[model samples]
Target: MTETQTTAEAVTTTRPTLLEARDLHVEFSSRGRRARAVDGVNLAIGEGEIVALVGESGCGKTTLARTLLGLERPTSGEVRYDGNPLTYTSKALKTYRRQVQLVLQDPTGSLNPRHTVYEAVAEGPRIHGLPDEQDLVSKALSHAGLRPPDRFFLRYPHELSGGQRQRVVIAGALALNPKVLIADEPVASLDASVRGEILALLLRLRDELGLSALVVTHDLGLAWNIADRVAVMYLGRIVESGPVEQVLTAPRHPYTQALMSVLPESPERVVLTGEPPDPTRIPGGCRFHARCQVLASGKAAEAGVHTRCRTEPLPILPATPEAQAACYYAETTTP
Candidate 1:
């Protein structure tokens, strides 16, 4: 077998589950209409596994991440940690957050301009009432690549470069010494050169600390670089998921294929047509049927699954460890 295949197979695991979502759902009510930001979905992050959640904006990836982080309460269903269902009590949630920290999209906005580097990194430990704030802060900063940690003790958000600001945000989460990091677009704001640095830090942390992560991003390139497994979201559900290399290189779902086709410098590009329907008025059957290239090109009909694709929902089926897709046509034909 080739080196790439060997590497891909290495990540296909049945490790003990660390975090899980069982039929998770989250909804928002507005102007007499309800938006299902996160519809019925199930996902798991194995201990020491790095799973990337990929999707376009407004596709509920963020809502899913927030719900998993205990920041958003689901309308129904449950989020579980180590076999226990999530509880909404303030004390319980607070303790949960200490183990699963979030690194937001924007570093500048996430950090207060008034706070110094030391103060920013120290905040998490303080909030959790953890002891040895100074030591935790110093170690977190160093771990995040801000070495000679004392040198940055007095620097403000504006004083550091964009990459440094992001590192500070990461350090804050690290001070809590989280086992799981839910990083939403961690390197989105950094320049190309700096993006690599931040990504490297995340990988190192995962290897050295045995930290698992849920990296939420739209970039397939980033997922290929960092994730072991990947879940592709559409509208309010995970339509496809599996090992990253398998999904990225041989995506079976039509939506996932469209996404991969457009990766920078990819040989072919699939430009999708039309805006995603309003979340409040999500379409029936397949949420992606309306935008599906398979349906548009008559392939689903050719395969004898088109009508079913438009009138019935398909569950995400992992026929094998390498792949899964919530598409009747893809599943039937993906031998």
Candidate 2:
């Protein structure tokens, strides 16, 4: 992979922190079986910054997003917004809900067919008792790139195309005038031709509104295109995270390197490999041991697979000037 610059150096800031999660864990019990969807994840999103959470499906990206939104309760750990503990019933939570919104993966599933675009977008303002509902809806539609705005006002979810429906969802989120947005696979269902356009809209929203975002996706190229920071997750854990360029170009974790290897160079390239392991029966320690090529290249036996990756979970250690990886063998440039 070609080396690239770090996002930290690309953007100038005073290290302003907007949201933080400390050792967050989310667990569930189904029919006497215990499963931990998120395990001891730590993350921070800075003001006006876009952070991308990239991982395979079932890696807990969506679960983590739900937890952050206060839609799902964590089994342990803490979530803080602007340094205050998040509470679902607190007065601050009402304010926080208004300041934070989500754009779900399936626009059709989330949107109501009974409501028109105008009603859908205006719902937030109406529920929150914000003044000037009509004006806010108009502004949201315009901001979402549905120019003229009148054309989309009477359209239903089925009346609009996939991309158009997604834009409506974004407009609805924007109507709340949120300071932070959590987009879970916002462009996953759109056609290739429309994906870039949607991504551009998101970038525009960030720039024009000064909004911070946590975009959850499995596409590295998409993350490269829009994210300021990239967090690579594996088996419910953040295996590698830091500035987008640093994590992509100079990956520290073996799992991260493996993920990047599959990205096509242009539009026609392919990198084939086995699928990731089952989350329910995740391997001990690293949880990525089953698919780690470096670990399976005849060196694992000598290194003792159980000893290196099954006994003790590795901590996320600093691997570069501005990055961290949770692999014992992660490379570092300095030292």
Candidate 3:
């Protein structure tokens, strides 16, 4: 296979971290109550690594992504690029934004209906006041697989297919020569056939450009398809994280295990009794204990498991050198 060929086993490695979030917390207030979207979250993305942040809808993944990009200020904690805290000054922020690009979930909404593909892709360079705008736009379009770049230059968004539109959006991001890309549900809006193509294009971009990415989605299959590592978020926190294979195959946290159990190919099916607990009123002690089967079935209480499960929240601790989970019984429970 060629070096850029993507297969079942995707390439991934941990070099120095390029972007990181330390104890990040983002909260919003509504009617006198504060909602903790991202609560004390810590994450790191090594150069060239694809880390998939997976969870159900409203699990704070998108909020965390925005914080990492410096789009939203955290209630507390900090975001760092190349080990340095992000700067908030206008010039600094402009430079930082160029290095960290965001690919929105909806390509149609992201691209203006009135703008041609060339105009859309050229906007970044124009904003940055860069010369050689045409070269940058053409190269970005080509890199994003909009081959014969000239062919699509004059086409408007409505004239393109979903996959083509997404590629155009990606091309626009590439126009800035970004070091990292934060894609939110990149394939959720594409057809099944087109989804594979877009994913392949992303993998190719990583292999060819040495770009790092944080893919936020609920699809475990997508993680398996391209990501080297996976982080499972729940109720504003990372409940489990590790190499994709280890986390998907032998998940430690009950929440992680339950998620994996429901896959069409999973050997066991874990069906929790109720919907996820309200984020504004997240349960005390173990956040998941309210619906955790081990505790609910009386097994944990009978075995006299860690009493902390009934009195204090558990912090995510390492299960292996490369993995971590945030459950009191993560190491002992079968899930």
* Candidate 3 Cα outliers beyond 4 Å, as residue runs: 1-13, 316-321, 333-335
lDDT of each: 0.87, 0.79, 0.85
lDDT of 2 by residue, 1-335 (tens): 11111122112223577776667878888567667788767778888889999998888999999899888888887677876779877676678888789998888997999999999999999888999888899999999988789888998999998888899999999999998999999999889998999999999988899899999999999899999989988877788888998888877677777668777763333332577665566666677766666566655555445356655566642222257776644532325
TM-score of 3: 0.92
My TM-score estimates for the predictions, one after another, are 0.94, 0.87, 0.92
Candidate 3 versus truth, CA RMSD in Å, comes to 7.0
Best-matching candidate per lDDT: 1
lDDT of 1 by residue, 40-158 (tens): 77788888889999999999999999999998999987888876888999999999998899999899999999999999999888888889989999999999999999999999999
Could you give me the TM-score of model 1 versus the true structure? 0.94
Which residue pairs in candidate 3 have backbone atoms (N, alpha carbon, C) closer than 3 angstroms, thus clashing? Answer: none
- Answer with 1 or 2, whichever has the higher lDDT: 1
> What 10-residue stretch in candidate 1 is worst by lDDT?
1-10
Candidate 1 vs 2: which has more TM-score: 1
Point out the worst 10-residue segment of candidate 2 by lDDT: 1-10
Model 1 clash pairs are: none
True lDDT of residue 275, candidate 1: 87
